[model samples]
Target: MKTKINLIFPMVVMALFLFIGHTSAQPAIITQWTFDDTIEPSTGEGTASLIGGVTQHSATMSNGWRITDFPEQYVGSGTAGAQFIVSTEGYQNIVLDFGHRSSGTMSRWAEIHYTTDGGANWQVLANNNGDLTPHDVVYPFSFDFSSVAAASDNPLFGVRIVSIFSPVAFNPEAPDSTFAANTAYHRARTPGTGGNPYSGDGNWRLLEVTFAGEAIMPGGAEKLTIVDFNGGNIPELNVPFYLTVQTQNINNEPTAIEIDTEVSISVTSGTGSLNGTLAQVIPAGEHTLSFSDLTYDVAENGVVLTVAATSGMVLEPAISEPFEVVYPLENIIAKWTFDDTTEPVIGEGVASLIGGVTQHSASIGSGWRITNFPEQYDGSGTAGAQFMVSTDGYQNIVLDFGHRSSGTMSRWAEIHYTTDGGANWQVLDNNNGNLTPHDVVYPFNFDFSSVSGTANNAGFGVRIVSVFSPVAFNPEVPDSTFAANTAYHRARTPGTGGNPYSGGGNWRLLEVTFLGEPLGILPGDANCDGIVNILDAVTIVNYIMTGNVHPFCFDNADVNSDGLIDVLDVVGTVNIILGRVRK
Candidate 1:
């Protein structure tokens, strides 16, 4: 499930940032003109609609629908015709493919014209003679424009396709009457360089024109995120596997042409970890990075894998967002719903809370709610609500909960915990960072196994403190307004190596669940003095002689860690006490 720890009871002023959120993948192909369809798609035309990976132009069946009038028809003069906009940032080649009905004369055929400016002028790239035989060869028509697209000073990539049907004069200039008039109904007007947008369609039909080349995308690839393997279809158990990295950068620019790069995988956190770098020159798009031979084993639980691209070709490295994979575990040590009860909603447990903590609809659904979140100031008042939980023998715990916030920029709240009865506190969130947006309240999760002193302590208590922040102004005394979101982001302490935030990071908290294995046995400390000594050895002897028995972390008590713990262990304990040999 999801998880939430304590809350930062901070109340403060206001500040906001214009966040477009984060950048995502860009379109691979700018525009494709296929005579079979429309110029744009239905509803999603604004972003360039796609049909089987090919972005379709509008399928104009109503106003501008006709037939190709072959290159033999009377055409217009000067580059003027249909226009379209294209965003070719990192591409460098111009490719064209067309189909003509006749083996027409070379000079009387159609031609392709391109422009960089909006369209006050035009330039010829190639003629339709290449594809005159109809689908001659898919890759037959192409031109290299490295000098054009690679110009660091220029960033424009617009083109207007026009046909030069018939010349006004065979030799000298013919009278204007000799040229086909496109305005006349049912007449095929020859297309050419320089004119107006084509209305009545006729002449050689343009199939597909592309402006593609190697695109040097920054940061490994784009929108580097993890998708469920096989669409969440395959079982994720003890199966041997190789992770498939869908390099969003299609061969279109998977890697800089002729340049090889190094790819590495590192497990920064969680139940599993990885360390290896692969030397590769990936001209192909999708790739497979093996872990089976790399010894990247995992617990039945899940792990977070992040890959980075290191290349000297570019100035900086490209790292990916944390990609998490959850291998659901069966054991749930304890669960708390805070659903109108101060007790565990699923398993047996209780919460010890303080400060502006109360039960309200802060979560929308009826549950335990805490407000005035993020303390009015930092320090002791930084606690909006707190709790103490014990994991009998469990380790690798999964903590999940629901959370919502308001007037928070980021790092406005914090979750703190102490396994040793509040003696010392640790920030549940490693450091300062705000990854969640406060547009709405939702479920969140993270593995708590990394925290110190968290496992096998029956009295393991936790505290949630609200740090002081000033992300809001005239924020009023925070009331029932801090709730739900259409987005997500919770504020973490600044300098924790996470995204930073000042204040206005108040929150509404609810439901928490902990999943882990119960501590199986007590340690060799038979006296429970937190240590194993000769006295414990005497106790074990007493148990044997008096028929008394018990299991401590039997693993720890078995000094030699041997299977036996009887008279045989007495000597071992004595040896440990004298420091002759440590247990």
Candidate 2:
């Protein structure tokens, strides 16, 4: 029941939910009948027929549909009615509304009933016990027709009103179409002559009659979702695949009836989008259609291809969330952008939280400010700057950092390697080529690839450490003169060897990109015009798409070096342009 339902609510007009058989909107008044018809044999407002009922037709009407002979000495039972007939086929949850007043509440209650076989067998619905009397004031009454309709095999229904008033206890249908308000069985308690229906306020009056029902029609259309695809559920980037779509009636309308509705399907973040509408001659229920042929596009690992359904009808189209498709990476193992955010945005690597190493603002991306550089390295501690890199033959560790210090009190950094997890440490690399302390102070790169490992092993790890050096600024304190560390923390005034740190100065490291050996990529750089620019990337795409142009070298064109030329080259080229790769 979406409570009452969906595709149908079992949802009312105002998004209201009903506790009906199915989700649906609340029933509404479809037709009504008010006996204001001045003309006889009235074909009233709701196209209803005034059948066996007393006709008090009047050009200048007074009050309502009434019966006479009330407040008289009692006799046998009497029954009379102004029966209004209407149809209730092809719909359910029916309701009837009527109002009337009478002269006696002492009489047995009147009843409202329905007949499926033209008044043959009457199933009593509601009674008039709640109607007011004596003063003859109009009151209200309601009856739920859900059970009666559900039990019936037929749709044609009739409503009958039977009044059993007076001293008569018998309740029966009026004799064939005439007013029985004065029937011998139904007598009033009043012991005087009761002839005029208008004279006395004790007459039975049927003021109005109306019908309402929920059409049993659906309010929601079939949902749009991805189904039965040829490829495996796991997506593969840049692959051509076909998937059959189970497109049902978007209008959720009963297909038990036929109609013309249009449907369109398209995809976002996916290649080869469809553009067109289809003439879907839908059946009473659910079914499917196929997109036939489609090519999944290559995208950033987590990008999704959203297939959406759009229609120009009462149906709300479906928009699917991101769908997964990916091509596992090769060659490049990890990439980090310390843009202040924890964890790499695109890599699966280990970043140790040691010392006072914290994310700090930098000129580009994010930087790690190495604050209390452990005066010592115990496999961890202040020596830890960022992510750990396990070396395997020529594992390139490229980093961007800044070094700042003053004479005789400057801090120096070194790169060390250990195949035994820091046990047997060795001078793996150094980039302060000039041997100058804190020379390249703000954004420098340590091309660790230039120095190869001693043993071709996987356990080989590398770490960057700092040592204390003395440097004197011409002046210190608020008067300037002291230099800031690579991380940007200035040397303490008077330089008092600030706390546990030899010199309280900040050092910064921004980017650290690691890749496998043989990254002398010119890969993605097809035209080898020195740098791997967008032009080289374009060359590869041209060769693959048109073949008229070719790359200077096939090896170079294999951007990701998957040994294949496709959209991945374009992605790789883009990564290169954005400096996501340093090889």
Candidate 3:
């Protein structure tokens, strides 16, 4: 009994060691050629070629490489094929795999060959030649070269697959003359028994020629990891953010080569979808990938990003840490539709008649309509309509609206805006930075997004009024008649339109809006209640002196934006509340 037990234990231990050794060995990708994008190998180093009379070409059909101009079936056998040359340095247990299919009249049998000296000499793989039975659909084939010690770790290693004639069952020494001549052997032939003979016009298509082996060093990538974010993970809604990804091996190190793989990010947990440049191709010899200008519209919590590679890349998808997408701080400060409502729909504002221009209910549309005007081109730069809106907690103010003119109205108008409560005004210029042409038409947005001192002002206002063209005052005197496109005032007056000065025509306005982005932190509002006052100064002082744990905004406490909250900041805050300074 003791002898039998000892023998069984030794055998069991041997089997265990063999299983562990086999399972530890993983096949690393030495090279791969898909021919989907470039003629170069997809993963590592390799060059493809055609043997004998075969011609190789690239096409988008199934993203495969094609070989054409073959010899007649059963003729030139064991000669025509495709070859892939690669260096298997730092690898062992080499293997070659590919997918191939043939046209109806193409040769069916092919043999795999290898050359350890870079195609100078070749040797046929024993008993590896077989029939490729499928047509159009790919049939997979693999060859193991573990016994060929000379093929491993060789820089000049190469392999090729060639068409070969198969022996007939009755005549073992002769070629199979009827292999592809009958209907059963061709894809497009009729069901009847008789068919045409195989022709050289037929061709073969091959894809995914992969060369793999056990690596002596770190190898192919197994997973992806997000390395960094250009705009941070918790970005504002509708704001663009870029992210970087790295391809990592099983040991969590960046792979040596992550080429030809496409990487993309998808919103796996949020209602919003990713927009703009979602996927990027990993360039040759590069392991890190980057995306550009990705945005989400809706603010939501637990927004997760799933970074994925293409299916053929054989990489595990990665998940990003859950992060929240917050609402954009900027908002519409005030908007007036002038469609039965003259006040702003968003915030505090009012639209009122000014400059002797009265409102009419029924003309071009429901808006502020003006008719009466000073004689031809007289009140050009001095009269029209006015809009007042407060941008108290916002910056980067902009304006948009719609305006129309009657056929008889003046063709030119001046756009005037005030940032200091109408104390001073500046004329908005055309896109060319000129104020004379006034070429702006209806439904336009005037950008003040880059202009300074146009935001957070309680006295902000805008005025659109009549203006005379520069052509009318070429000699410093008003032209007696209106230009070709000019119109008279509300009523026809004598000597208008090629006559003396006359007042005739009308103007209509609607949908005036003021937009701005919320300030990151209101300069003097230490408590962050959307206002600057005495309490803000007191809040700053109390927090600094007593370390009081009251509600506070550190950014607001630094009133001068100098990264400090001391007596100087307190003084700046006081100046703002006392109307002695402006932010």
Best candidate per lDDT, number?
Answer: 3
Q: All candidates' lDDT scores?
A: 0.42, 0.46, 0.66
- Candidate 3 runs further than 4 Å off: 1-275, 278-330, 362-366, 430-441, 472-504, 522-583
For residue 572, model 3's alpha carbon misses the true position, in angstroms, by 9.4
Please count the clashing residue pairs in each candidate, in the order shown: 75, 41, 11
RMSD (CA, Å), each prediction: 19.0, 22.9, 19.7
Q: What residue runs in model 2 are displaced by over 4 Å at the alpha carbon?
A: 1-26, 39-53, 57-62, 67-79, 103-108, 130-132, 150-155, 165-203, 219-583
Ranking by TM-score: 1, 3, 2
Ranking by lDDT: 3, 2, 1
* TM-score for each predicted model, relative to the true structure: 0.39, 0.28, 0.34
lDDT of 2 by residue, 190-269 (tens): 22433333222234655445566766544344454456565555544445555554444433322222233444555654
lDDT score, candidate 1: 0.42
lDDT of 1 by residue, 490-511 (tens): 3432233333232334455555
Error of 2 at 420 (Å): 99
